[model samples]
Target: MKKRFDIYKEHYKALISLGLPIVIGQIGVIVLGFADTLMIGHHSTAELGAASFVNNVFTLAIIFSTGFSYGLTPIVGAMYGTKLYTFAGQALRNSLVANTLVALLLTVCMGILYWNIENLGQPEELLPLIKPYYLVLLASLVFVMLFNGFKQFTDGITDTKTAMWILLNGNVMNIIGNYILIYGKFGFPELGLLGAGISTLFSRVAMVVVFVIIFLRSIRFRRYKVGFFRLGLSRTVFGRLNGLGWPVAFQMGMETASFSLSAIMIGWLGTIALASHQVMLAISQLTFMMYYGMGAAVAVRVSNFSGQHDTLNVRRSAFAGFHLMVALGVVLSSIVFLLRDYLGGWFTESPEVATTVTSLIFPFLVYQFGDGLQIAFANALRGISDVKLMMLIAFIAYFVISLPTGYFCGFIMDWGVQGVWMAFPFGLTSAGLMLFARFNYMTKNR
Candidate 1:
């Protein structure tokens, strides 16, 4: 028993060592998104809604690529554990190609979506406002992909803090860009909603360029000289990368699609509901991103332990992360439960929207534990390189069950957006329970 407790102590230390940098890095990205939303919100509600629409469209691509690139963490973690620096470098190179190809595909899909924005069943007034803005953000998918690729590589080698710095710098630039472009400050032309998209594009491009330079030329990454640009692509590397990447990308994209598509569901509720949904999504993501930060740490730690053939430690790390997550979730939900009313008021002026948003707080509270569980075990599974099965589980949980339930509760039952939020507890808890059971079975038998 004492030994078990000591293991938990070490695992907790390892988690913080990994998780703190990730938390800061995630915060940088979230802050950028929040700033964009705030600036756009103040400009006009129509602009705010359009921004939400554009972001939701592009976010599918971003989340999918991030998952695809996540193939790196376990691979690099294993390589790093074995002290195989060159192999890690080669893995990073292969990841870049796989991610770039997917980015191109996502861009083409976005192009189709852009042309058909009018067909999204949104209010006629919103289509024109949403169309042009969506295209501008679409152009940045390649840059976002590149940035994610670099981030995954850095994260794989346990150098996550470097990505945090790059993200912080980019976010600062994004804010300044938003101020200059959205408001037409100084010599810049006022682009309004268009300006917000352009600002994001510029920041993404800048961040990617900076990452490439640092990886190639900076003294810090200079030692990992695993063939930055000199390595040739091998069919073997591509196959391995895809084997790890594709399922993850698909699973994550599906889950994100659940939320992104919920925007469509909320659209059926009318403008006020959609707007309230947008506000809740932005705020909820703040918590989700934090969960993601810790989950990423769990993946890294478990993968590192697995590379050492320490199955005991791997399970220990996962449980530690799960405990931390549940504790944090309970605290966060309480804060939200207590302050939902004030949160809505701070974000927008609509009293009706505030009341509607407050009503969803209970559902949000209920789902916190499930979200914590799913994130913990899915990440644990990913670390053990069992990504494909996890993806299948996510599909059933999010799409097969969650979305329809959300639609039924929200539309058919007349619960509105509150009903949509209610679906979260069911979906997340289902996914969590199934994943935890899978992890237990796998570890016990292995």
Candidate 2:
């Protein structure tokens, strides 16, 4: 017992050492989300609903892009583990190209969606607000992908603090920008939701620029400079990245679709539901992004171990990540539950929105376990390059199970938005369990 306990403790320490910076950075993102929700929610309920729809649509793109960027992590991690500095640097170059292409693809797809925004069944009055904001966000897609590429590279190399610092500062700048523009501070015109969109676009661009400059100029990256500049894009490398990236992207894209699509259903219930859903999503990020941070660490560590053929450590690290995620879900859910009443009020003064937010709390809390579970194992699978299955698992959990459940619950059961939210736990837990089973089987002997 003592020996086993000591072993687990060691894994915990290592995982936390790597994960803490990422978690802090993710918390910064959550803080920014809270600010966005608060600012937009108070600007006007109509704009809030518009922002909700637009943001939900863009989130699907962002999440899919992020997942595609994750393909870079394992590749870089493996190279970093092998001490192939030049190759890792070369891989980063390829990743940038791949990420950019993905960005353009997403941008075009979103652009098409923009062309038909009115057909989506959202309230007609929101079209004016959604259009410009959607355009602004669409323009930022490439920057978002570029940032994700750089971030995944840094994290894979275990330079987690650099991206963490960059992300934190960028988010702070975004909040300040949001304040100045959203409310028309310092003699600026109050553009409302458009202001928020402009601020977000500015922040994302700044982050990418800062990340690139740092990567290019810093002495810390001197080791990578030669390869970064000298390595031309390789067909082999590009193919590998795309092959790996698509599966992960589809996996994550489907997971996000479950929520983004649900936003549509929530929108059908009216603006109050949309506003409440937006705020609750912000609150949900407190745990989701934090778990993602740790899950990312798991990927890095597991990839590193896989590179070294240290199967034991890879297995240990993945399970350790799951344990940590479970612990986090427990702590965060408790805090959220305790503060349920006031949490909604923090976003908006609308009594209806606040009440709706409060009601969604139960489903929000229930999904934490599954959310954490899926994040840990999904990243673990990425580490092992066992990702094609993830796409199918996501489809089953989200499309086959989650979406229909939400529709049935929200409409047939008349559970409204809460019923929609209730479908999450079912989907997430199923995905988690399947992912866990896969990881367990894959590493069972090896």
Best-fitting candidate, scored by TM-score: 2
Candidate 2 local lDDT, 1-446, one digit each (tens): 88876777887998898899999999999999999989988888888899889989999999999999999899999999999998888889999999998899898899899998888888888889989999999999999999998999999999999999999999999999999999999999999999998999999999999998999899988888778899878888788799889999999999999999999999898888888889888998899998999999999999999999998989999988999999998988999999999998888989999999999999998889899999999999999888999999999999999999999999999999999999999999999999999999998888
Which digits, one per residue and each the tens of the lDDT, describe model 1 over residues 1-446?
88867869988888878888888888887787677777777777767666666677677778988888888888888888887777778777877888889899988888887777777877677777787788878888888878888887787788889888998899899889999999999999998888887888899999999998888887776546646556657677778778988888888888888888888777766767777777777778777888898999999988888899999889999999998888778787878878876876766677776777778778878888888899899889889998888788889999989999999998889888888888888888998999999999889745
Off by over 4 Å in 1: 1-4
Model 2 ranges with Cα > 4 A deviation:
none
Model 2, position 72, has a per-residue lDDT of 89
| Candidate 1 C-alpha RMSD relative to the actual structure | 1.6
For model 2, the run of ten residues with the poorest summed lDDT: 2-11
